[model samples]
Target chain A: MGQTNPLRSARLGSRATDQFYEDLRQGAREGKPVCWILGALITTPMVTSLGIPWVFADALAAHLAARHQQKRPEEVAEEKGYLRETCSYTRIHMGCTLLSEEDRSKVLDWQVPNPDFVIITDGCCSEWVEWGDDVRKRFKVPIFTLHVPFLWNDKDRDEATNYVVGQLKEMNTFLEDTTRRKQDWIKLAEIINMGRQAQDMRAAGQQLCRNIPAPATIFDWATALGAVFNSWGKPQSVEIYKSMKQEMEERVARKEGAVVGEKYRLAWDGMIVWPEFGPLSKKLASRGANVVTSAYMWGFFPTLMDPTDPLKSIAWNMVDVWANRNLDWQINHVAQLCEDYKVDGLICHAHYTCRALCGQQLELMDAVSRRLDIPAIFIEADVGDESFYSEAQVDTRLQALLEMIDAKRKRRA
Target chain B: MKAVAGVDIGSLTAKTVLLDLQGQLLSYSIVAAGMVNRKAARKCLTQAIRKARLRTSDIGSIVSTGYGRSLVKFGDRNITEISCHARGAHWLMPHVRMVIDIGGQDSKVISVDSEGRVANFAMNDKCAAGTGRFLEVMSQALAVDLAAMGTLSLTSTNPAQVSSLCTVFAESEIISLAARGCPTVDIVAGLHEAIGRRVVSMVKGVGIHPPVMMSGGVAKNQGVVKVLSQLLKTDILVPPEPQIVGALGAAIFALEE
Candidate 1:
């Protein structure tokens, strides 16, 4: 059984997403209100049920960067005294807001829909706070921050759960005041149920990459993230994952991999350099080494939450963000991913200026290698800034890593 | 009578080496790398072949490494400098557990296992701070020859501190020091110390295990080597011609092939 590549599904999913953006843009233009939601905080089912169009600012930044137009906006942000060391995504978000409404019309390729207000989460990466502040200052937009607490094992689950529930109720009041629309409890329940099904199916698709000669690569998982986030509660999102999971299952039966001549399985940790994704993935695959898993790409797996109690479910999901976790938790999560994938090696990308991600990478690399008996390599580069990456240097490190893996295998044999 | 050849096309220079079946280096050449890497590679290879009194057809295998490896269309295969450097250092001194290579455009520290396989490695940021280009720029600023700066720096009693690891910022700092009539030798010593400090951290980052050897064009600078050895607190080994180690390793790979 030949595996069905999600190429068709990806195209359809992207088309649907594009249509959603266009619809939001048109609505915003006609004075129909919209909210700007951070993609990482997208409890899409709940937000959609609020009867307001919402755009994920990070997705729009990803969109512009994918189109190769991210640098100018970042430069614009930096010129305004935002530290260059800040997350490029945050800079890009600020840059999008800095564009004059008239200037934005010229580059209709990808624009953050005009926002009435911005809703985001606190207690995640501290960068979100700076990003939220910049938006509030520059765009004169009001920000509603859902403060999720960091859960230590010492704390009771109910404490965190009840706190998030309270915040969700506050969010309901904010939306009602901003949009002049009342909350519909019945509609919210249906959205939450759809979201639950969609999450389970997507998780199933992601888990299938663990098979030897994995059915799908990390790139596929990354590509499907937009659909998973944006199309949550839509039957189409569920259908996409259903087909993707079926294809992966067929590949598993055939012992097929996403790349030909699969010689080594690896997992990637840290944010991928978006600009180099195509070239880098091709280079890895050409060497018969495929990235079978990544903690970054598969974040936000569905946690059990009651569909009837939508606010509690959304609150619980918000607290589960990987970025908010302690270093020990992160290390264990990555170690578990390594064991789950049975990876031969780990590629720890030390992205430039990403204090949150790169701060602990040195420890993570050494720990994973020593604990798991898996060799790991550190690749230093910036995710959005092309100037920070040295292609030859990256190639040297990757080749050496692959050769080390080969040596380890030969030693075993 | 077959011989193997290795070509290393670095950012600043292209080098080539010819070796016999017994792994003895027969001949080698190092030349300035111009705008075109393919042309420079061909030039170095032809010169090295002629120096050995051998025809191109006499070479049985050809392997390439370094930044311009892909541009060598005639080569049989291209390998990365990390693997090549580790092999070369291991060939020279089998006990070398760490290799620090400071090239024209980049600096790196590679950790090697007992069998000469790369265990782990770390490279400098995408800037010319602890690299040959930094020295070249500073030498120009000081009105001193690149080769003589190293020897001159050894004479300094008290070196002026050059703190910035950034190439551009350090240049501005050097100009102001020069304006203050600071001795060229002292400033040059400071430059070496700055580079040594930067490279020492990188070595430690990869978990500094010694019997460490240094390679690449910058290895010829005794000022840097002396300061680096002092900073690392270990004797650093350098080959007769530091620039050709990558090429030598490429030849070693060709012989095995």
Candidate 2:
């Protein structure tokens, strides 16, 4: 947080976020019809263009709960008889809508706005289907769900693209009926182009990390890349990426890295512990070890899309999202990142309750280490839940890993 | 000779080893790790110093290891038990390539390089099963001395099976086994087997390099060692004083500096 990235200016960072939320709250207060959009398949630009406000329930709930030291939204879901084993992101997002009025009033109480409608996509996690149902029940809003099948093999790529394209057409019709406005193809293509530009800018910024004494840390990527998820199709999101890319290029030219000494370059392959981000980053900085790349920060940049074909482009992008792919794809993708970032070691966080994230991680770690000939450390931590984290446990484990890296580097020298 | 000390404040026990500049063992002390880890660490180190007929100032450097390592405020540095165990086990048995450390709160399998550094390692998740806590709880349920249960379990004609991996559930299973009038010896044998099986699975994940050795307090259990060796198809080596391995590793590290 201490002067890591110049891209994170007051306007593009916290102030912009505050204003965005303030606009949403104003929308809700004015009885504007709010549409709830699932993460990973965010259609913010589509809804924004229609003069409709969209809500990302999980992001709002997670940020508020962690910042205000209130009961995590996941706890609320558990109270409503959702099993603790449910994905934390989905549970917390669903829990935000389920919070009783009185209970919501006591906490940071950022209520999930009463939705005019909710949209669910065939997102990476299987839990979104159930999350959409919960949103429907709690808010009593009509729900639109999209089904996008897995796209791993090249053989079925065309079929998958067509299927998603068809769904997008149906979604367009649904929007027209709901808002009584015809779909604007030209405007949509422009938005898609902006989103594509933002993706390229962000990727270029991340590529800069490959340089020695990385211009940005993994935490910086996590923070700067977040807007891509929530607001990517907008001009503001594109501007954020533009500023970030410029700042990173300047840092590289001036020879500045995230950590002071920047001795050990590392890559992380898991979600950051959002609640403990400050403490964890500080600890790493204190030891002169910085995470230059993170697989989680690699946004689903739809590979090589034709901007003229908006629906097909969106479909292609959805399938390319990191979380939606098979383990082999993930391993190879992360291996490329490790090589690109010039990583000395890899740290894989096996999240406590995240089945998708934890699946085949041991095998992934083994394969990556073998391929890259670098040491990998597998640590157990809960990304969203602070209750599962222990400072003593993490500190000892990390100290040992850093020592191992140090020993390996010295041996190499 | 300059003296150095390694203090390991684990979940259940605090162990300290005093070593001379040549890395020769000077004296050692072990004490119950009570609630106050700092107190336990101080108590063990002081006892170790007295036994060696040296004053506190005689100790040049003190390195701490284990869960409570950070609580040793006087420590010159702290390292994890994973690295310490690998170093200590490799130091004691140079040919040893793997270290299975089953401590009070956690159990870990460490693969060590030829130069006695951590190559790779795997540890049990955030659970109490397959750890010293599991053995302690089972010994209590069986109403046997924690030290003697291992020997008594070896004499069992039929080892009862413990199906639960959770320590809490395993205790209940042990309780029900006793209620069913099952022989305490057999139940204890089965409990050891359960822990052995769990540890062996973890070892297999990190991969078993020979010769394998057992460290931590759990290594003292003959029943666990016998079952684990049979399961792994490899002889599990235990040091002369198995519980002091982590502290010994720390002392070796202190010696190097």
Candidate 3:
């Protein structure tokens, strides 16, 4: 099996480049082929589109190796190094995507004709690796390179224009140097227009979906898709929101049971399926406590967003409503859920890693508690990092709360 | 003399105090935050006014502080707990240059100037490690009322070391200690020690100054205070009803207004 080694070292006189090449050479000599080191900027959607069979890093390496075949090995290596240094997610994904001998052989041996042009597009955050790979796979063309820079909303338009112009100038320089072609000013202008068109399409799509209710689960997926596909069109957020509301209504209606033992209904809001969710639910069940509803699972409903016009939809949904836009709408939506469920208490889990989600937990808890007179408990936990959570501590708190609720019920009885 | 009322509705409790034009605390009341914060605030205010035997109309101004200050319907002014705690602690202890408040869901260290204003402060509102809530969880795990944790911790000979700083993990760690036949008192003492260490790190992060007054509900726990004092190598002062310091500060603000 002729294994194509994706790892390349160009003799560019830099010690770092030399060392990287030497490492690859050593691996090759040892019969361990290194293929596909993905940068963190590649997203799941990009991966799916690229028809890449391997993980993130491996797919990235393979994509780069195939796309930048005409370029010297050192240049590709430098790009990979630059990518790893900047993005942690890219680094993690790249590490995950590195391929073994059998996998490397499969990718290297696969034959596809090279295309006339390759266009690379990136959103604000790094997931551009997947998009680049997708274009490479589909067109079989070397990307001439396309980059979309992200800017803060408060950024001055004049400053942004200057920055974009500077980027285009740099790309022109790279094209001249790489292809040994003279600066074609007219073609350059056309290329800029194309980039703007792509950006506009995505922005338009996001705007159309701006009104979509954010479903907690499908947010990342919808946002990524919108950024790649729908920059110009109106976003599909409103439709998604309506669909989600319908689904939730049906689910709630179906779950509605006869008022049997206790009239008190408690709901846990915030991220769940965390370390203590199993134990917490079990404890509540043992006490004949019915957790009538939760925001954690329901928060991710897909109907809250439509990805038909993904870019505009994502941009609209990702907007921080509390500090920037009034979250009165979301507050009312949550309040309605509580009322419809006939909830008596709410447990607000303020997860540690999520700054945006955690910021509003206390305020929301206070508001809902006041509006409904339902006691709310704010349980703190780290969703992925279990080292921070104390199970015994949480259980004890929950037990005390249960006793308090029981006492309240008995007094009423 | 102008009379004013300041309400500091904290995460764990609601506090209200009455102040005269001269900045003297005429009367004060503390109440647990039940299901309804509005009712709790009204009740605390009524109780404090009753203690002074003054009419609500006599109050020239009303100021609110703490996390729950925004919810106070009758308050004329709302101030951050950070500023309120600094002002209140300065009034209570004139020489107090540093103030460490461990509330229900958050912890703060306020540095005051000679004139008694917030010079610089550091706060950890993101985690439960150094807050009063951590102790509450541990107390419940030990099957002890929150009030008894301080006294009970004093009796433990060999305190079990709680390694986890996270509240959820600390609970499991306690259960594991229990399984390993560790005494409940030792575990309780360990929890206090862990919390003290966390708080000490935070205070040290901000560079601690002497004459530090430990206020808030956690200040009531002598074990935590003792360990915190030892860790920082400084004497910690706890006022009667330390939880009301923010309210006291708000009342003082009302007096100045």
Candidate 4:
């Protein structure tokens, strides 16, 4: 019940996230162009390298949920026709954006400024497109949508590549026209390479976890996702991931463990309960179990691209994020992660509202479970809504999983 | 010289099983939890103690199980119903590798190994579609006695189609069918078929290794057992007193401890 042992560099992520907001507010304070990129799509090197500070639309919503302040934003969003059953993270985003300046002041210790421009990268679902249109109307700002197609390695792969390249070019032109700043090709390439380096380092840290007494738990990596989320193109990510990798390397050398008495090593397959991360991590640690690897913990590791060719690089990242892929791809991807991590079991946090991630979890769970010869459990929860989670139900399911694992260990022994 | 006890406090009922030093059953009792579950567990334990004619001090160990296991303050240990049911069913029928336990709020299929250890399990804890409460709601809608619905199901020549994933909605659907002159026997049969199909889906996920068995209050319903056995294409074993299976499992753990 104490803080999870092998204390990770969790504060690094918190610092990175805080610095992200500060940089955005600094852009707003200086009256510079600040853009809002909705969804995890292709809105990257072009905007950030142009000296225009950008923020992911749902970033603050995730922050609020982690800090346990989702109630007020949710209430406000509900009053404005956003239902609880429809993505609480989006509802909170809409709520904060729609709030009157005075009301927003009352609800916040800080603020997210209205964007000077909005780019809707609606590849995975139609929700982001609608959210983009709504924000465009509200701010009356210039908006561009890169219609990212969902085919990376299909027979029509070349067509998908050309389609995204054309859109990315047009979007770059649109950005140049809106901000009156010429595009910098060399600088763009430099940023992509840096992001590649950072992503590679993060991936390396994850790979080192194949060691027994895994040097890092998923909590360490999941918390530090802010580096990948906020500062991928910046030197900050390189430094953050470098330190992270060094810590993991040192741990691996010393044969130190992230969990105190780690008896089990499992992997998480879906979105985390951000607010309950500490409690959940501690609870698992108390049981001598460590969730050493997770699907989301590596950030953009699996979305590997040709960093030398920047357009192809961004295009691949834009199209192949796990959210946009089909079930077959997801099942194989999860299976590969389990094999790489050598996990004993899997826990899929089936967030009720996330149709994109959890849509095929049952089939994925069954297929991967049979293929890998390990058991997987599904825990029902929502990304940011604590009220939607059932603590007792989750506890019972997890306990049973541990029992099954124990039986397996006994049989092996 | 000493006896061990197991107390199972479920959503709808609490059961207590007492065992003598030789691991032989001494006595057991079941009490409806009503709205006050903790009180029900105490009363069930008290009745079992009286029947066994033993004082509380004579019990050397107690293991509590089921949904309300956490509320049993005097319990030496609390185990999940999933494990309890698996151990109990496997003890009763040594070859039983699967158990279908339908409690008041949830239903679960537990796969057991040869040694009575849980190999795998899947639960319908998110919904009440295939649980005892689902049948109870339908029986109330049909004006049939809770115990009589099972017998009536066996007489259903033409079982009606009752397809609603939700228990509350299923009740309304049943009512509409009854209004349209659909027979209660047919509807009861439909309910049993629905629950049987749901449990089969769960069992398949855990990969059925059978000598399948049924346990819990719903196991007393012969029609449900018959339907479930037919659906799985295997003869199912039911303990003579199935309601105390979880408590029995817990008592086994207490005895071992």
Q: Which residue runs does candidate 4 get wrong by more than 4 Å?
A: A1-3, A6-8, A99-110, A134-142, A151-159, A301-308, A323-329, B35-39, B136-144, B153-161, B171-194, B226-234
**lDDT, candidate 3, B126-241, per-residue tens:** 56675777777777876889899898899998999899868899989999999999988899889888888778776864568889999888899998898988899989999987
Off by over 4 Å in 2: A1-7, A68-72, A302-306
CAPRI-wise, candidate 2 is medium
Q: Write the per-residue lDDT of candidate 3 for residues A125-202, one digit (tens) a residue.
A: 234456446445644544434343433443443454354445445544544444445654443333333334434433
How badly does each model clash, as a count of residue pairs? 0, 0, 56, 0
Tens-place lDDT per residue, model 2, B220-254, is 88999999999999999999898999999999999
Best-performing candidate as measured by DockQ? 2
Best by lDDT: 4
Residue B164 displacement (Å), model 1: 1.5
Provide the overall lDDT of each model, using Cα atoms, as 2-decimal numbers: 0.80, 0.79, 0.55, 0.82
> What DockQ results for candidate 4?
0.49
lDDT tens digits, residue span A1-413, model 4: 22366545655877888888898898889999888888753466778879888878766677788777677777788899987887777877877776766666545634777888888876876778877887888789989988878764557666777888888889888999999998888888888888888878777777788988888888887778777778887888877778878888888898888887778889898878876877788878878888987766654635665557888888777766776677788788889988888888889888876777777788888888889878778888878888777777788888777877876787889
Better structure of 1 and 4 per TM-score: 1
Pick out the ten consecutive residues of candidate 3 chain A with the lowest summed lDDT.
A2-11
Query: What is the Å distance of residue B255 in model 2 from its true position?
Result: 1.3
Q: DockQ numbers for every candidate?
A: 0.66, 0.67, 0.03, 0.49
Error of 3 at A144 (Å): 13
Runs in model 1 with CA error above 4 Å? A1-7, A29-31, A100-106, A152-158
- Tens digits of lDDT, candidate 1, A1-413: 12223333545566667877877778778777778776445555655776677887766766666556777777777888778777877877777677666656544665556678878876666777777777777668888887878766425557887998898888888888888888888888887777788778877877788788888887776666666656777777777778778888888898878877788889999877777777787788888888888888777644655788888887777776666567777788899999998899999888775787788788878888888988898888877766677887788777778878887887789
lDDT of 1 by residue, B1-257 (tens): 46898899999999999999889988999989954389899999999999999999999889999888889999998888888888888988899999999988888899988877788888887677879998998899888999988799999988889999788899999999999999999999999999999999988788999999999999999999999999999999998888988999899988988
Q: Which residue pairs clash in candidate 2? A: none
RMSD of each: 2.6, 2.4, 19.5, 3.1
